[model samples]
Target: MSGGIGRRALITGAVAGAGTLLSGCDRLGRDERFQRLLRTGEGGNYAVLRLLQDRTALAQEFRPDQRSPVFRMNGVRMPNGDDYARHLATGFADWRIPVEGLVAHPQAYSMAQLRAMPSRTQITRHDCVEGWSAIGKWTDVPLRLLLDRAGVSPQARFVVFHCADPQSNGTMYYESIDRIDAAHPQTILAWALNDELLPPGNGAPLRLRVERQLGYKQAKYVQRIELVSSLAGINGGKGGYWEDVAGYEWYAGL
Candidate 1:
């Protein structure tokens, strides 16, 4: 499975798996107007969820024995490109997660550098909106630690993950979280899963894991982290690839 599965195939599998629950929502995938309406509804839910939830609420964590026997790979399985191929071949020895945009000191961290920093490990469940769930252990550096080291600017309002994988529409895959989520204790840039160096199917090298949100919010194959005041100008301005294409909610809070 090193080559990984195609993005369309993964979506189809998810759609099929959740068909029973999505009986009336099928067309939302292709209807732009409906998607916008759907987003509006999701926005309201988000507002209410945020209002009622604690600022630093933590997602439930599990014990090692509770981890799922098999964790399905989500989102883009393999990023397409010679450069990515080279990194994969070299075991990401030369790969870097560049931190830039609205930061006082922009910095890029190689795998070694990122691994050298203090890391946190947690066994947690990943609930996908597609009506499935899996529990796995994730280990990585807290995003705030990196942001502090980078000296994130006071004006920055959101952290955007620029990934190596692109959607079928050729739009580069990305996801964003507000400053509040960025500084959450469970929010990390994970480089390992299940106590092992993350496999390609599970976002090797690095990935964003904002534990409080649903699986879609966890952007994988991350290449860069961009700090910005707003997501209004990125892609379709929906804050994420699925949000722009599949009408998936941007704020997929549990």
Candidate 2:
């Protein structure tokens, strides 16, 4: 079968599984069956999607004049916690991002230090999983430069971003990227937007800009950077917050 046909079959199977549970008298609800389908098909779906993404052309970028006048911030608008509040109150003077794991050097970089690094500016569109897109300009140090400075180990296959956003159950938000995306030119730790310092509502202090993927891949309010060979033990072992809790695709390649 063609790749497209195969993908369609996989999706159809998953949907059919969901429909069965919805119409049955079984104790398992439709939601449970949907989650089970996602769990069972996640790896294969990711592999197929990744193959297609790798073969496709790079995602389009926007002209500076085409950038949005006001890009609406998606996800947690403001992190709620005493620690985050204290940093905000103090103007983030003591805010630091701890960088460690599978590296020759481990260091805690203050926001000022991160800002001092050489930076890149790009006008790009953020496509959210919920069917919205916004173009904006961003400026930040490339993640590759920071990873290089930290001496990333050869075995490090994934870079995980730990954020400060806390859900009702008190679990922190986190996401991971493989080495290919990690070394991509557009992967940056953004500190500014639209030629101005980042606003608190839009992930002030620092945020990740992973241009090839969707908005959620660009984790906001970043607090820690970890290099890991595998994501088996991080946050329910599904690789990200949404992946663990909402059955969202872990490899959200555009």
Candidate 3:
């Protein structure tokens, strides 16, 4: 079997066992063996995933005929906060995405300005960390163009995305990408999908489409972009929400 298949199978087995254990009892504190087994199993799977991502080339896109009949939304379906609700009421007319951080020039851009920039469209596959995939066409402005316009400084090595979705207590969704992926031709801030205006369920108004990585890395409902030299000072200091909270790999470059 291929490396991906092998790794996926192992992860599946571990998850199954973990689920069984958790179902049997709620006291993870009492089950030291179960806790150790779960952690080790998850770690092994993550390590293998990282290895596969590091060794593999960019994922392949597809022809129009190969696209999915139903490209379901994978992340936040609707943001419930008052701020998001206000924007939605106005049809996002007042929403401005703040672009700041270590750049020579920091600015706020409206959705109109983003839509006005030169754009690229691609029918790429969206691979989820949960082991599912779908193909959908994306239309957006190349991320490099926006970065260039803001004059990203040489010191800026990573771009952090701040979003509107809240995942847990006092926690927000965020992700970061290195300069390499930022400059990729396929990297975009998508505003449309499958030839339709982006839906609220699929990060309407704006979203990041870092085609080279998994779906989680494609942060949705993006409200801000921060350029930084390092990811050390961010929440949990692991570069992303899932990475920090759930031990997902930070550099999911697949």
Highest TM-score model number: 1
Stronger candidate by TM-score (2 vs 3): 2
How many times do residue backbones clash in model 3? Answer: 0
In order, candidate lDDTs are 0.88, 0.85, 0.86
lDDT of 1 by residue, 19-115 (tens): 8658656766558888667668777988998898798988899999999998899777888878888999999999888899999999999999999
Q: Which pairs of residues collide in model 2?
A: none
* Candidate RMSDs in order: 12.1, 8.1, 9.1
TM-score of each: 0.84, 0.82, 0.78
Clash statistics: count for each candidate: 0, 0, 0
Better of 2 and 3 by lDDT: 3
Q: How far out, in Å, is residue 124 in model 1?
A: 0.7
* Candidate 1 stretches greater than 4 Å from native: 1-39
Position 159, candidate 1: lDDT: 95
Q: Per-residue lDDT of 60-174 in model 2, one digit per residue for the tens?
A: 7779999887899877888998988898888889988988999999989998998898988988999898898889999999998989989999999899999988976789889
- Cα-based RMSD of candidate 2: 8.1
| CA lDDT, candidate 3, residue 109 | 92
In model 1, the worst 10-residue window by lDDT is: 21-30
